[model samples]
Target: MTERTDRTVLLRGGNVYSPADPFATAMLVEGAHIAWVGSDGAAEAYAATADEVVDLNGALVTPAFVDAHAHATSAGLALTGLDLTGCPSLADALDRIAGAARTADGVLIGHGWDETGWPEGRPPTLAELDTAAGGAAAYLSRTDVHSALATTALRTLADGLAAQPGFDPDGPLSQDAHHAVRRAALAHLTAAQRRAAQQATLARAAELGIGALHECAGPAISSEEDLTELLALAAEGTGPEVFGYWGELGAVDTALRLGAVGAGGDLFADGALGSHTACLHAPYEDAGHTGAAYLTAAQIADHVAACTEAGLQAGFHAIGDAAVDAVVEGVRAAADRVGLPAVRALRHRVEHAEALDEESIAAFAELGLTASVQPAFDAAWGGPDGMYVQRLGAKRAAALNPYAALLRAGVPLAFGSDAPVTPLDPWGTVRAAAFHRTPEHRISVRAAFTAHTRGGWRALGRDADGVLVPGAVASYAVWAVEELVVQAPDSRVAGWSTDPRSGTPGLPDLTPGNPLPACLRTVVRGRTVHLA
Candidate 1:
């Protein structure tokens, strides 16, 4: 976490990957911007003038990743506290929680437990959580963060929980009930603990080659004080650049006051699919009830109008078809009120536009909306027989995360991990989109990579960044790879051969079984944020 002081550096013998010149072999970093890029010989000439010269030994260098949607404080907590992402069964999850609770002195907080893959096909009940916590207050969030199970002690601490929607006193809580408990549970962490957790998450992101993170904060997700503190921490230059988005309805003043990039990010139109709260047009295959909808079309249109008039970016968290319909209708109405050109100029975004019909896709393109999608959602719950199929049946499931369709319709695609729901694996996210379970829905590896990189920067209105070129931001990552191959849509093996004439740089072999490239270093503004 040391601040890099070297003002000038020459990176030689590396394959520089950029859209303009994908095959360049060297780059010169002067202060906070890329000064030059060309051959190794050209870099060598300026070596004497540089403050430092580092040989890359033929490593692949590209723009560092920018995660468009993330919950900074929650991600940090999950990193430092008990993580049950790998627990195979409900029994194992409870056992791990019990172990953590035995040693933990205060409120026990844990995350990332998914029962969809478990044999039980159900989460631990409230009684089970109580047994695990041994009377201590505990709140364990499901992998999707849409729902959570709380011990009786914790529920007692949460005010008016029984009166809230999605309340089940002895079972999992969703919607407002979940939000209430989450807020109470997060209150247990002291300021120091929260700061340490945030640092830990950002450090991990740097190691994974991430240069920036968009913190999706809200009244329901995290307090204004927490968001203020996180923004202050990022301003100190200790971690990646943090773009704050306060998702509260009619909170433009709050956003501007806190120096937020937007007033909407994870401003829920609905919940997530895994929690059976994604506001589907039809009832879930597994459950009788259709999902919940937090915002009506009128409400969405109103918020968009307010944000647009105030010159702020407006967005929503919409996953299911019904929610998508609502969002599209809202955007259409906003366009009517503010004019299509004005609405499009704002470049409003929709987080997790996972389930969309042809009509919705057209609406996104016509309105010039940015789709901030998470490919890992498809990787985790997609496929022929994955959790999505179990909940939605075969016909509806196959339509999940239609990346190819979205791209073809001209919707701007920005990729992210939605971390703590899925770990922040940028490479894995690219692979998942390329090798999507529905073959016709898959995109090329290069296209997927661009969405994660350049598309993400564009989402935050950083058009000049997320690309490696002269005069661009000098934020990039170096990786050591075993082999290089460009992935083709039809066949993985067919793309193994290098083709310089293809006008594309060789990317890491990211077939399902191939190992991802090991990140050697991550540089932000010509400063080393992580070095291995």
Candidate 2:
């Protein structure tokens, strides 16, 4: 790795989270790589020569997080614009929109509204949205971002909107209609506005101790301009590193030209469960239909083959058993065509992968597929009485997001926030996985944390970047936390590790209801990006 700056920094007197030395209390960063990790006594040798030395004062230092899947522009817009994430009622959401409409100038773009939990049990009608926007154009995406409510004004701006599948004159738009209106709404943003939003998102990520993010952009999800600008901003080396995944079939050349790491991500095999369009094998409990399937197995096979042949990672946003089946079938078909070794070498990915089975899990491991998952989704919409159960019935819903099973079957897992849908709280994500609503689905907190950190690097085919070892990338965070605990895979095992004899490095106490660690500093590649 190239050095970002010519300087060495000594961070001592802190809990250094490193497997090389579990009881390590100090670390030395030499330019872009970690130079040493050991006891505070050993750090004295490097402190005198270091350009800057910081006494950590008992804080914990660990590898910075990597958000495996995100939509930067949309997340920024939600951060800066209207956010209906916790709006309890439909009326409350409308009132919030009305209030925002009074002050908002350009298109009123907002996100994270789920009607499934609301008393109204449905999204606002087009007329209600129009009134909330004061007859101006407005687009409010559902929590899933697979559907949205677009006012008449915004709908009118989307040429051929009515003819698209999922077009509706009264309620929230789904599928193509939602995408068209979203594009039209985003088109209202000026270049400066877009840049500000992107910057805001990156700034927020750095502040939260995230050192890297995978921007999931596509022709249907966001414009090529958005991806390019985001990549350019990250390249300035002032914020978290960003890698892009452009979801398009047969667009390998376009992905390479646009500097995308993969031609997959948000390459939809189906819609989301909340919208009752997740392409299930059986009909939804709420909706009669089996949901929508965007791509056939053969199409997925063709795309996977193309990507593998081009040496680009291929992935899909599959969230239903039917969709997961299609991905497995297709990827395996591609393996048969391109040879298993060739397909396996690329390490393809599958975003979400919420709805999976034993077969799919085995297939993922066998084919070297990474499950880029968002555990926060379960935190928000899992459990017996949650939205998943409402849509899928308790039996089917209980099987959603079986992380422990996947890991048991040897499937690679990379955790993410899918921000704007779920907030970017990495600690919360790990906690969610550890305390999964379904007890059988819960993984060890340490395992979950590793998935969010090193697993993300592995997903990107970077095997040695996320860990804190000599010669490894110096991308990490310092946190002010109450207590550190070594949570084991077996719940029966002792969690508190006050003795150095315990070989495992401890992490922040992630017991539910306890406050998460506050980021004291965030450094990426030896360059300080955020400090508080």
Candidate 3:
């Protein structure tokens, strides 16, 4: 950990947005906490006692972001390795893969390939992947990270993947088959490579103004050794504070033993929508089949009850309506077993609550379940003619990612990027929520900003760290902004100007055409992690 010293630092000439004093223009940091916050003129008095002073040069300062859900090692690999996220078509993706294979030292692992916007509207086949790989093993995960395309060499490395439930020898693998192949692919990486990848991802997070991250690891996603290594790295205090969550069902002891904050996160209730595996009540429009459900209500109830009794947060990856229903039923049953108060006090969470109905929304609010969601998912695929409409048709697709409805129903919302699925862009995530495809579902800019900052802390059961105030932890970011405007809740695009004399803090102008602020510096616990 970065050693906290008894040094007083003064920051002046910047706009400080704090919950306690919304219009402060300067702040004094005494050790690892805020000592004073007030006007720039008044801050001059602190210079006599300050060991260091920084002039912000009219920048904007706010609380640093916390990503509630992420995959650190995989995201790092994508950052340092071949990335297929920008491939324009199937042919382009193949050419890139073949080129990567020709130069790779060993197995080639890549991520972020989405066929949704492709003109061909389809993914490359296993045969195509094999040809691209030449003689090497390769595994490329789709944008959702729920499915992957692997070469024959990689498949052969997994002993029984060919016979797994979701396996297709000639097509992309989902569920068990994908998990098996992924484990083999990950095993090929050396410990040095893993550490380098992890460091790269953390450096990127700091650049994007993220102060903390919740790493969702599991038996299927990553090994226990990987989680231990990552937690140890966090202890070094060189990067973001990483909170680990092991998503193994009924493994509360293992999670506690490994120093994980939760027993469940990305504990798959079903697969993803793009892969045609997300368990749904009704059949998909294009596939003509109801998606797969990995766990039943009874299984969910058992896990929830056990985790709650153990005083650990329990969560699941539920995207489809059927999976959401199963989660609600399980929570109800767990509440019955343990008292409702006990269950609610645990602050259990649900990841990607995408297909919720009225009842599920109410149930989540009543159970005090935090919705760890990704607004970037909606931004990428939630428009009228986006991939979601192609998958579920118009009506069913329109209901995805109802942020406004969830907020109105009293469900606590925390936002993240789900990196490697979507890039780690906090400003983009906030803009996506504010400018939701369905206008009725769009939230105010302030609400979206708060969700990405304060809500993320609450999701990890750290409610006291996301604000800038006296007695609060000194973690924040400085930004270069083009304009400052406080968006009005009643207007869609207008009514955004603010008067400085009113003493109300103004947020960055996030209207569609306005440029988002660029991060200049990120500080965590009085230590500088990133500086431009």
Error of 2 at 508 (Å): 1.1
Per-residue lDDT tens digits of candidate 1, residues 300-362?
Answer: 999898888998999999999999999999989988998888889888999999998899999
TM-score of 3: 0.98
Error of 2 at 338 (Å): 0.6
lDDT of 3 by residue, 1-532 (tens): 3445677889999899876777788999888788888889999999888988989999988999989889999999999998999789989999999999988987899998888778888888777888889968998999899899999998989998878888987888998999999999999999999999899989999998999899999999988988999989877887788999999989999999999999888899998998888999989888989898989999999999999989999999999999999999999999999989998998898999899888899999999899999999998889888878978989989999989989999888999888889989999999999989988788988888889999988887778888888888888899998777777765355577677765568889887787889999888878878989
TM-score, cand. 1: 0.98
- The CA lDDT at 294 in model 2 is 95
Error of 2 at 58 (Å): 0.5
RMSD, one per candidate, in order: 1.4, 1.6, 1.4
Task: Compose the digit string of candidate 2's lDDT tens values, residues 1-532.
Answer: 2334979999999899998999999999998899999999989999889999999999999999999999999999999989998989999999999999999888898998988778998788877888889998898999999999898988889999989999888998998988899999988999898988888888999999999999999999998999999999899988999999999887899999999999999999999999888999999998879999999999999999999999999999999999999999999999999999999888899999999888888999999999999999999999878999999999999999999999898888999998878988899999999999998899998899999999999999999988999999999999998778877657434365556667889998888889999999999999899999
lDDT for each of the candidates?
0.89, 0.91, 0.89
Candidate No. with top lDDT: 2
Error of 3 at 166 (Å): 1.2
